[model samples]
Target: KEFTYLIFPLLCFFYDKNTRRKEKNKRHCFLSVPRWVSLSLSMCLSQTLNRSKMNHIPIPITCQNDTEMSSRDIDYTVNALEVERILNYHFKNKRLVEDALTHSSYTDSVSYERLEFLGDSALGLVLSIYLFLTYPNLDPGQLSLLRASNISTEKLARVAIRHGLYRFVRHNASTALDDKVREFAEAVSQEDDPLIHGGTVKAPKILADIVESLAAAIYVDVDFDLQRLWVIFRGLLEPIVTLEDLQQQPQPVTMLFELCQKNGKQVDIKHWKNGSKYIASVYVDGNFIASGSSEQKEIAKLNVAKLSLHKLSDSRPTKMEGLENTGELDGKSEIEGAKQKLHELCRKKKWPKPSYNIKDEGPSHEKKFECSVQIVTADSMLSMTGDEKSRVKDAENSAASLMIHLLQESDYL
Candidate 1:
């Protein structure tokens, strides 16, 4: 899990025509949008200021009920109300926010992976529009940088954090206890640390992802009613600036560091075989994140790691292809990474030594090969199965448990 703030109330800055915010704020407490965002938004307003139609205005919230939002919850709470207000303000579409917050870590009854994908693209488009229109004066390079800066994971996570979004996240307990959500705590309360001891990191990533996915949702929702979107974007951004200024710089993913939290996640050299091809897997907390069968594992690791990192949100859209397809970074794959850090526990116990072997065990031997993982006594693998996942833990029997975990794990490729 990665770890990583505060600002303007969206209400004051966004809706100049004033209809809902005033009506809304009295009934509920909405989260704040950071002042930094205003810089990009202001740039857009500068250009549209004179246009009677484009200048600051207000539009209807469209959604009167949040049933769709609540349905996404595994255990609903008042946070659904918070999501409702934010979604209403930004997308004027509540469904997107609900989907973005869905976590794959939740029980089978809940998970938001598909929604996360859609939201990811949606945020990208919104960021692009915010940059382009805001910076009528900037060249392409400057616009790119500015957009990248705002849309990066760090920034997006901050957006979610500032608004008290994490308190609403759904995941196993370990994650809820992590510092991953600290940055998202309100002005008063602080969240815990950002490392997933077990399977909870999934929760934090989903929360961070919702920030951008929701942004994307707002963009798409706005398309049907541009004026309404503009007003909401205005409230969300008002504390930042005239839209024109936001376009002056570029936005980059590097601005965010929450993804860099203490999971022992890092890029390392690794190799695997897919038919005659060589592939690589990136590991975090001793678990495979994304893997590739490539001639160059280093580059493959980076590409897959980046893609997996980008896919943190449940709202994100992921493509499926067989494992053999992942070796090429440009191609898509249906592969899933390691189950959780149970593999980390095994590695900690040093139950199995790391060994790289290259033998073409034919497909016919798949079952026998899997069963023999422990017979070789070389290494153990751990994975998360939906039902029993929570039972695997760092415990009194951790050493033996580690061995057991490794015996069940799968190497990513």
Candidate 2:
């Protein structure tokens, strides 16, 4: 009877009302069950019920139409429409606009990747043609540099921020991205120059991709007409880098190398990677001049070279009028004497020992050592780099001598 009672509940839970009713009717015709059987059935039914509840699976929620969308999706759609208004050109296929702004993180649907690729090629071609026509006399090298500056990632990102295109980018990335975009926008706002590259600030790549994808979308919508695409986008890429700008601000490495060569000196660049970042050190005539760190190896090298060039310019002799000729002071004895004097001065002043950073450049047969020295005193700190030396000790001595001369001239000795 107990087992029968337990089984009854199990049957009720498993079967629908009609099925349970039919089964109950059929059970009534059977002989009465024992109480133990009823109890056992009830226990089994309860266990089954608990197990079912524990194992319940939830149905995924999906939106079939705009009415079913959450407030966030609605806002996203509205912003997409506003983008068209901002551009003042409606996308014939509205999906293209959405595709341009849709980052890979946003949805599994089409993303900006394809469009970005297309836009990259289109942008390069357009810039090449524009530059070729604008500067007929400019060589291929100059034209290439000019085009690169005008349509670079930094330049496009700047354009996106200036025109408020980033706000429309549909990305599902973390709030960190929002913060980065905000920071980049603020940085651009503070910048005075309109045509910016990566020199002053680093621009986010996503912002640049959005601009390129949009350009590609425009090209596709206009039946792959390059002229039509240019007509729409030429003004958007304002303050194009001209030949004059390139001449005024040649690449840092180029400028530095040229300056060194003109003065009958050699420039060397050495770099190493630290995790994901790169550290670059510049040596002018075998002397450690400056160092820079960046996420990119090329950028780091450029920065180090630029700093070295600036230091060289600042240290150039202003008036060679009354100073002792110090003609070709590259001998071993002269360097040793200068190093001894620098050490004595530091000891007399009770200053900490001066430190030197040295680097070697060139082949084994023609190795050159560059050294940088920093001397910190009670009143001030002095840093100087010496001309390159054939030996490490000589480089150190040369650096010490340069610092001593600079200190005496500055009246700090």
Candidate 3:
């Protein structure tokens, strides 16, 4: 009799799932079952239902247009519309949006993993096309750097936090995801730069995943129009980094290497663990310049690099006189008379004079001169090599031009 009672509920559930859509009136027929049995079945369905079991036994899950939805369904739909308002792009299918926000922790329905995968690809393509069109002269390498900076885990996670997208994520109530997200939010609130990656608190990947999944939902809803996707979400991705922005935030490690190379000195950065924090020590020519420690190794490296720059700055030569200050530096002057301009900049900045190195190549009739220009900053010496030219003077000018451009990009100018 106990077995019969258990089996009866399963039969009733299967019947309810199969008949609920076909004949709405017949759905009530399962209500005729005993109260305790109905309660037990409802509890089981709510807790254990998944697609794999549904394929085997046909458990009734909610349909797209079911009039009688649970309170949870209504909440998800409302959240979807709110997100639509935030994104300024209405979804034809609210289900996709709901799915995007639904974390794997939520047991009732689909998660955003698949949508995130699609969105990741779509976002990359859209950003690539935008960069290519917007910056006609940028090399593929530079374009790639810009795209990466914009879509990085830190960048996208900041987007989610900045726009309150994190509020829409549906996760298990028992999980600690909310606490971690709150902690991250609090940490980033103090940051001045929205796109900065190296911070005291690392960005939780789930926040980034939410942005990607939402993007995928929009892409799918709009029939995969790459341009339309950009048009819709461009505002959300505000303050997109441009070439100038990219130049402003130079990689400290690369700059350090270039600086040491120009000075004919070797550079080395050593990493070690000091208790819970990571420590990075910057060395030039086997001498320790500065050290920085952080919770993350990369952040420590960057900190040390900045410190090293300051240290080198203090040891640089005093400013030389008699060079005219050409107001603010621009690209045209850097190319027109790069050699003289570099000398003027070195004088104005109170740094060491610029030095040029030349290499001759090819046969005498088709000879070429490759020039490398070097200059000392406050803490380090930096070098820039120009394209080979037929004459030594032209090569020297080219090298100086490249050096000026490097300084501009690195914000040294």
* Consecutive 10-residue window with the lowest summed lDDT within model 3: 318-327
Residues 213-299 of candidate 3 have per-residue lDDT tens digits of 999888877756788999999999887877766554555566667766777889899999989899999988888899999876766
lDDT of 1 by residue, 1-413 (tens): 01101222343355454677664652242323233344333323433443444344543223433334354343454565667675556333444555556565666433556546755665556567876876788788666655554554444555565566666666665644556465234311311212111111122455556665555456555543444555565454323322333322101122112343423335343567677567766555565556544343333443454444433321122221121135322222212322133334335643322211111224533411111111111221221112112112211122233323334333321
| The 10-residue segment with the lowest total lDDT in model 1 | 367-376
What would the per-residue lDDT of candidate 2 be over residues 109-207, giving only the tens digit for each residue?
578999999999999998888778888898898787788788877789888987899878877899988888887786566433453335334678899
The TM-score ranking, best first, is 2, 3, 1
The candidate scoring highest on TM-score is 2
Given candidate 1, what's the lDDT at residue 261?
42
CA shift of 49, model 3, Å: 32
lDDT for each candidate structure: 0.41, 0.70, 0.73
After superposition, candidate 3 runs with Cα above 4 Å error? 1-63, 66-68, 173-175, 265-413
Alpha-carbon shift of residue 271 in model 2 (angstroms)? 6.0
lDDT of 2 at 43: 47
TM-scores of all candidate predictions against the true structure: 0.36, 0.55, 0.54
The TM-score, computed over Cα atoms with residue i paired to residue i, of candidate 3 is 0.54
Q: What TM-score number comes out for model 1?
A: 0.36
